[model samples]
Target: MNRISLPALFITLVLTALMSATSVLSQDSPSRVLRAGAYAADITPTTFPVESSGSMTRRTADKAHDPLHARCLVIDNGETQIAIVTCDSCMIPREIYDAAKEAASRITGIPTQHILCSATHTHTAASATPTFQSPAAENYVGFLTEQITQSIVRAHSQLEPARIGWAIGNNPRQVFNRRWFLRPGVSINDPFDRGSDRVRMNPPANSRDLLQPAGPVDPEVPVLAVQAIDGRPIAVWANYSLHYVGGVPADSLSADYFGQFARQIADLIDAGETEPPFVAAMTNGTSGDINNINFFEGGGHQQPFEQIRIVAGDVAASAQSAYQRVRFETWVPIKMRETEIELGVRRPDKDEIARAQKLIEDAAPGPWSDRRLIYANETLDLAKYPAAVKVKLQAIRIGDLGIVSSPCETFVETGLAIKQLSPLKPTFTIELANGYNGYLPTPGQHALGGYETWRCKSSYLSVDAEPKLRQTLLALLGEVAR
Candidate 1:
């Protein structure tokens, strides 16, 4: 190198600066935690309401609106910059998820790994999962995706430091086991036994049963509330094992019982007695075997639509009870962990496949539902293995409070597992938080064959996903804490 004149020296300095600028432009900056806020958009589903339940119209009505729900949560927990959007829909194809993540990244500098988008698994809402390939909902999905991304961006702009709290309350009575195992040649539903309606129910299948009695029950209603320092409710999320969707027959889009309860939380909090700008984001937990108003059990509550309000009241009461009795704290590290774990999907025996073909050929009835029959027929050609299974389990530690996400419809056993092993003084599990992959049964429950135990064709993972998932979640908790 040679000494340069003053003019040459200045030119060289400018060139060096330009080179450095080019290098910086070529790569993304080292990621860092950022501010957070949330925004929600309403895209409620609609259809002509038919009098399936308690409606003034014994005939029908036109275009009854069903409420769909969605929310975006921005978390700057000091570890990862995360943007989570929870939608009350069927499923959002992996593409929508990726696009949403990309949008969040572009708008807020959050990486896809840091962005978590999930479905609430409401049948009443528009289908996000292209898995079923609905030509009708395609436009709705696109519309919803944009809305969600915008919500994330808006929330990011409104980011502020917030304190979070966790509380546990028992609405244990509301959720119950829906699965009943038949003994070797037992009734699926006992007609002799007095039904909830006094009218007996015919057994679904009364022959060649192996087991007896009702199946498992998960009674965990995990409540996690987040509030700003100013005492404004940022969001209230809940997980309870109650399968109470009412499974609407028509097109009317509604968030079902879950949305009703969520609104109840908002109502309770927004009464000016507590705080303003509070949002309630409720999730479903291990409700694979749980239901609130059973068809054969309680004569369907005699009230259908009101069931939403009824459970909403229950959740509101429980949440208020928890709020009144619980303590609050902040400044805890929130760590979210998700893993792709392979589960053992069902593969019927070769003989059974052959037998099924023969039965179909003979025009004889099969032992499975139309869906199940289809699954069985296609199981052989099933290219899916390792299931690309993704379980999003998260632990948010706020001072002494802890909140964890059980991605599956975790069985009540799964919640107990978290509570038993969690290092946090108190931990709550929020269901349907991350995504919906159907039921997650305990090891033994898998032995009892039913809808809950029926292996999904997509995940093709283990029926015994609960225990292993619980252990893996605990390990993630350790990593985040450490």
Candidate 2:
């Protein structure tokens, strides 16, 4: 404004240029920052005498041995955001998950499609979906929905600059194929009085009639770990293809090995108390035909919850070993793609329904003791279902790691096939995600005629579901990889 020196003017001009450049750099820096947050929201039922799921008989739990949780992890890579949640329940219906996602999306600005909600398949948790003889507890379902929504909102609010890494670990000792082919002399009878079953589920342990496992087990333990910029653990999400290790007292509610794995992993990794407590979620993988029972060995009698602790400890150790090998990346491109595919349902015909009605009318008035009567009731219920259902499938890409989800109790072979054929080098599939669509046995497995192939609400998906789901998931993986 006044008469200034030429040198001063030159200095002022240079400073202005520098300031403009710095502003541009600052604006662009956000794209390089990767943010993550996690929280374990308690979803344990407040009231007692809640109905428990995952059994053929009606059972109620008066109290919880351990608290259940909806473990949530939210990840954002500047451009894309995703939330992954694993609830400690046997199986959650699609309506519940849809409601939670919509509520979370309204608050967190995350698209409903970007959220992947799954059940850990813990058999002792309060029922949220009617299965077998267990009916859904209406009050608990509402409470669970609110808790799941809050978990995502809280996790989103705690987002901070974080790094992530993943690795695959091996724990072949824990996973065993529960379905087995029996000897020729041993009779395999279905609930419908048909002795045509080629395979039997949970056959007598160490029985001479047991020939060999009907299917192979997936021993791969895939772990995805996230940590803050200062190296504090944010969350660890691990997957294993083993059904729940059931040893909980029949009268008590528990999260089974899934909850124990979370605690064990937190302890193993020294993830002590922090501001936003660390979360570890053990997701159920493709374990429809897999379980912890060793049909080959005469297993010793384990006290209540002893087997749960043992399996959890061993799996946590495997996760820690993989955690040690992780090479955390400060930022990586994140991509998630979701799609829905309609599949046919295995509905019972009129003749089958008539037979089922007759069986129910003739049966004694009490809890069902005969498997034939139980399946007959299932036939009547399945008759009311629609001819088709739409299953949701999602694929996520975080750097080189890929994850695909199926809303079913998927078979181990399907998972293995997906891993082998995925465009990504190391891909893992999460089962019972987004919704409950019943058991997904391969057509070949269905041909073998086993408990998993029985026509009920739990196994009503068409025989072709496995192949269609596999193809669609791989296609989704291809889409995200690009």
Candidate 3:
């Protein structure tokens, strides 16, 4: 063996030690920590005489029975961050949704596409659409957009070490299929025709003339629980497939059962900590064809507030059960993906346009009192839109949980189909997300010819829109899961 110089040997040993130390340091460096934050902004309008635009009738609310809010939950895991915002409104128009998201994105570094903004579909909330424009409505819209952005900013600022868990439970009793097939000779007339429809939406429950439901009900209530490092509850986001429980005092603004449900869940959890306490949000599920009314037994005579309390309590119970079944994990992955789908708008034929014009012309020059007149106006409004509309579909994967959101009032079957096709074992569908275009009825349901299938502003999408949206959402879900 040849003898090596002592100085050269010392230099070689030192270099090796340095390389080893660097490797050890790289291995020992801390990984990204999971963080979460919850925030709520009071979006209730201070101005009086606000337009409430869910029903066909034109109504304005002078007072609010309960406070309305824009609730936000932001989660960040080193590589990705997502913000979920739930607002109390009948349906946020796409224009407002986009503006709000842009504002929030500018305030926080989170991309606008990553923010999943949705409305609670509460009929009693303030109207933000140009169709229902009023002095109060315009002011409320401006206020709401600013407040929503503020909510996301507040949430991002408060990010702290946190863990999240999710669980799913069922509440089949509260939700029922709103559309039902009628017995022979009981068909109702379609909007443009004097003939009868095979099925009618919200058919009288007591009527012996009705057959089975037209669609299936989705009863899964998925709850995502976020807790601080010390295990204190930070936020609880729950989703249910029941439409708004009406019977609220007329002309009174309320968050519908959605607002009640969230407060009740927070109380049940006893989430009392920090200055802001815990925020609970209830997002609408695929309930376009679902409601709280028990059509089988006919309408119940429960008082207005009583109905809200009962429904809220029942939903809170379900959420609590799901909460108990979940296991919080501090280390997980967060991912978000969004896709824009351009769909053809269903256009009316010449004959339909003539009928719509005739209806509008024949009406007396005044506020609309009849539902038919309102629908006729809606038809004209929809006819003025472009041939195609672009909608956004978003999928967020947080660990093992997958959440898919859409802008339409999706039917329960469509939601079920999404969950069935999703790569995630248990997926949740959030309807009226990003914004509300109209009711999205499956092609099969459209063929059945019911209230939801009527061609108007509220249900103006093309017959093939549902399948197209479903496929796009599934693709996004798969991308995020991968």
- Candidates in order, TM-scores: namely 0.73, 0.95, 0.93
lDDT (Cα, tens digit) per residue for candidate 2, span 1-482: 78989999999999999999999988877678899999889999999889999899999999999999999999999989999999999999999999999999999999999999999999999999898877899889999999999999999999999999999999998989989999888888899877789999999999999999999999999999999999999999999998899999889999999999999999999996776799999999999999998888859998999999999999999999999999999999899999999999999888888889999999896479789888998998899999999999999999989999999999999999999999887899889999999999999999999999999879999988899999999999999999
| Model 3: number of backbone collisions | 0
RMSD of candidate 1 to true structure, Å: 10.0
Candidate topping lDDT: 2
| Whole-model lDDT values for every prediction | 0.58, 0.93, 0.86
Residue 471 deviation, candidate 1, in Å?
A: 2.0
Candidate 3 local lDDT, 213-256, one digit each (tens): 99999889999999999988899999998879877876789998
The regions of model 2 sitting more than 4 angstroms off are 1-30
TM-score, cand. 3? 0.93
TM-score, cand. 2 vs. native: 0.95
- lDDT (Cα, tens digit) per residue for candidate 1, span 1-482: 98789999999999999999978965654333323466666655433332121111122223434566667777676555666677776555556766767876887887666666666655555555422212235445577767777767876777777766667767765665556554443433211121222111123333243233355555555566666767677776676666555645454556777777777777776733443245566666556556664323344334546766777788778877776555556555555555555555555556656754654565544333354344444443343344345555555554555556655666676776777788876766666555555567777766544445543332334766777777877776666555
**Worst window of 10 by summed lDDT in candidate 1:** 191-200
Best candidate, TM-score-wise? Answer: 2
The alpha-carbon deviation from the true structure for residue 27 of candidate 3, after best TM-score superposition, in angstroms, is: 9.2
Clashing pairs in 3: none
